[model samples]
Target chain A: MSVMIDTGNYIAAKAAVMARPAVVPAYPITPQTTLVEGIANYVKTGEFKGEYICVESEHSAMAACIGASATGVRTFTGTSSHGLLLMHEMLHWAALARLPIVMCNINRVVGPGWNIWTDENDSISQRDTGWIQFYCSSNQEIFDTVIQSFKLAEHEKVQLPVMISYNAFILSHTSMPVYVPDQKDVDNFIPKRIPKWKLDVDNPITFGNIILPAAYEKVRKDMQDSQEYAKKLIPEISKEWKKQFGRHHGDLLELYKCEDAGYILLSMGAIGAESKVSIDNLRKEGIKIGLARVRCFRPFPREEVLKLGKQADLIVIDRNISVGMEGAVFTEVKAALYNNSDAKAYGFIAGLGGKDVTFGDIEKMCKKVVNGKAKQLEWFGFEGV
Target chain B: MLSKDLVEIVFHGRGGQGSVTAANLFVAAALKDGNKGVQAFPFFGAERRGAPVRAFARISGDEIHLRSEIYTPDIVIVLDESIMDMVDVLKGLKKNGRILINTTKNPKDFDFSKKYDVATVDATSIALKHEILVGGIPVVNTPILGAVPKIFDRVTLKSIQDTVKDKWKGEQGNKNVKATQDAYDGVEVDF
Candidate 1:
């Protein structure tokens, strides 16, 4: 492995190329443009041996991916904000049909206000799309997860699509030194996609045809079964990667100082990384606060959340809201602990519209809960709860 | 949190001044110096030229886990001195922090020299002298990086020259390295 100093998008681009995807269909968008550009550079330099297609729109990009992936070849693509939202329908199609397509979605804020900054709304809004969601905090994790996603997605036990999300500029444009493993090692880690099924012209078969209600329900149930299997397989793959590369960013969840603590802070993306500073500062002040950075949002990690809830109170700081309801993670975490454990969890809506959720802001939220002064839910930095 | 081993620096310049590249290249040099952790990123918004822009970098003796922007910087670099007119370049500088500017005048000319350590270099003139022009405008990012090694001991002028050469090859690379050397020699500091 060699250390490369560059931005997150470029590192992810190298990882994607190293994974050796057969086809890439991409469209440009803010914060996501550099990532695709990096891939194109690799293709021009002959490092990438794939059919790189320049699609018209975000919709066509995913459609092209679906078309290529249905042929039983590995496929990868990336986008952010509106681009990911535009592929909403195809996202469902890829997952329902069990294509192991992998993508990187830059976590940018949704529009109408025309703001292009870091927020989790883009990927969080696609929660029910049946894709395995992974939120990464560091460029190294982005690099590792992009490679690992292909392995996890294409696993026989879990043949589902994967979406790797990182904060817009906080991660997407940030430069850090990431250790790029040798191609031989990466190829050994992620072998060619030996799919169970595919479309062949010689032995033609129907794909995504109309189905009856009973068959459709069975498909949905099978997806759930695969997700549960994914929860078990994610850690196994992560462990193997670590054994090979001497680096692992955790699987399902990355815990920081959470072995024994009364209060545990919960978050994802860049804020999850910044929470370590808050935890360190709070620990110095005699607060037994730990951090459980949610790495995987689905299969929801209910078993893990239940375990954490049984141990300590959870304070969730979510960067995405469900409009009329509270923060998305808070809603789900509370449900995980409902009647299952006696632990209490508080929710704070923050970083929406790409507002800076600094370590100071995170510390303030944790202090409120530690002092027994927080409500069930509050909009951070807003006038009222 | 003022962790003793970490140093944060913010850069101020115009849209086309390469402030973002300055941070990136500067941190790359620091990484070569064997620092365990380094980060560089730009405060991105609109893409209008001549608008005040900012970039940030951090150097640490250990691995860096914090991902927030540097709220309080230990050093500030100004690629375009005129940016001071519209932006507060020293918004959150630490006490006795250093501020480097690309100005023709001596470091004593700036009132900020009284409070913070000041370093001045004619980076614009150096870029022009080496004919480093992009779209017919002097590119000061590389020249200012030359002065960085003078302030931060962890980064060396040799490392910056090597990094620049790796980014731009042949005649372009030689021109940037020579411009960097000139800026390093021309820097005047009020310490």
Candidate 2:
């Protein structure tokens, strides 16, 4: 039965426990601290039969998960902004080792001037680290994605780690009703992780040791191949998950009222949820605007994005900037549609460091696009440069 | 008064006064009353105990899609009476919006703008009477929340009581329930 719960972190922790990961190694960080704390509570109550280890730092957290996954056991961990960046080397190590570990990363601002607010730059920075990334917009989606991630990552054809991320504090601290499935049903949906290769006492095999340049090249190719395979497997898993769970959050991208839209608002994470309300309000005003929410960022969803580009003029709203260039999503999206279609892509940078982005702000952006006044690269809700 | 089906409320209190808990409990009570959508979130930055804090809640009959902080609220609840001395509690409140404060003074004793409907309840005394204290500070959030349903009428006192019972158990739960009942009956409002 589904119960109303406060915060997506608790739902994620509940889903992780339900997945029955054999090892949970995590360190506390704001926004993500409660996720591991909730797991510890489950362990203390004897509800989850797993080894919960409190690591010294975020680097050690991912390192512990990598070590545990090497032993062929299901492993889970959680971290945020600075913590995730701190685990940069191990993130590559876990992915290159082909460990199908699942983690929840709360998208907080990476700070030189200390901040704890929501921003996507933290996870977006790890796009090239060979992890399948899923950005969730709601608490229910967070729960559903965490469970589906285990299935998607553990598939023999796609043995890559998956990072499930959501806007820090926006989804993390917000209270909402989430439909949690029964443990028996979840177990049936997601079976125990059984690795094809593992560290065995008798076998005596070395893992992640020294390799020649040619072998290293082959490993890189294999990792890319697995990611390409995941693009196909993601939708298949979503279909089966919908059939079993009665909920579907699209495959890589979810389209909202885009059937005959002349203009489309493209966004991700919590901003996408706010855009839904903007689209609804705009539609009532007789504006033909729609929203295409990118759910998975790492796999890029290039094909689906190209299809949407063909449908309407794409206005990309990105919360993370690419420093000297425009928004990260904008740069990639513009490239994705460059040779294929003649879609005018307008990029808007907004909500960095967790500035509030509301339906009113989104409505104005869409109206500007509709009125042909949107710049090639504009900042939403920012008065001055 | 706002005519929209959605009702937004802002809770102003000290960091350790349980204002965030009050916002959560209000949403929980609204959910129990069959309100389809409810949300609550706190806004703070490296706050310590006794520091000014804010939290927001939204209750609607439909699913809520907006995740932004509440810029305009239909009601504002002040859990700390001293907050008004430091900050303007009525900054973004809608015209004809309501203000509920935890104070021993009468509603008209404070110099509030004439546009608002002010209400006051002695939640501190009620918390002390119920012994809902943590570290020598009275827990005034529950009593303040109890006065909310009486003013708004969208959520019921019964729902709040039931939610309190569902969240707590035994004597602790019963004490909170009694505090809620007393605050609901004792709150004085002036329009």
Q: After superposition, how far is residue A124 of candidate 1 from its true place, in Å?
A: 1.1
lDDT of 2 by residue, A182-272 (tens): 9999898889888979998889899878999999999999998899999999999899988988899888998899999988888999999
- Per-residue C-alpha lDDT of model 1 across residues A1-385, encoded as one tens digit per residue: 8999999999999999999999999999999999999999998999999999999999999999999999999999999999999999999999999999999999998998998998888899999999999999999999999999999999998999999999998899999999999999989999899989999999899988999999999999999999999999999999998999988787788889998889999999999999999999999999998999999998788888889999999999999999899998999899999998999999999989888889989999999999898999988998532
Pick the lDDT winner: 1
RMSD of 1: 1.1
Q: What is the lDDT of residue B126 in candidate 1?
A: 96
Q: Candidate 1's C-alpha lDDT?
A: 0.92
Model 1 segments beyond 4 Å from truth?
Answer: none
True contacts kept of each: 0.84, 0.72
For each candidate in turn, the TM-score is 0.99, 0.97
Residue range B1-25, candidate 1, lDDT tens digits: 4467899999999989899999999
- As a TM-score, model 1 comes out at 0.99
Quality of candidate 2's docking, in CAPRI categories?
A: medium
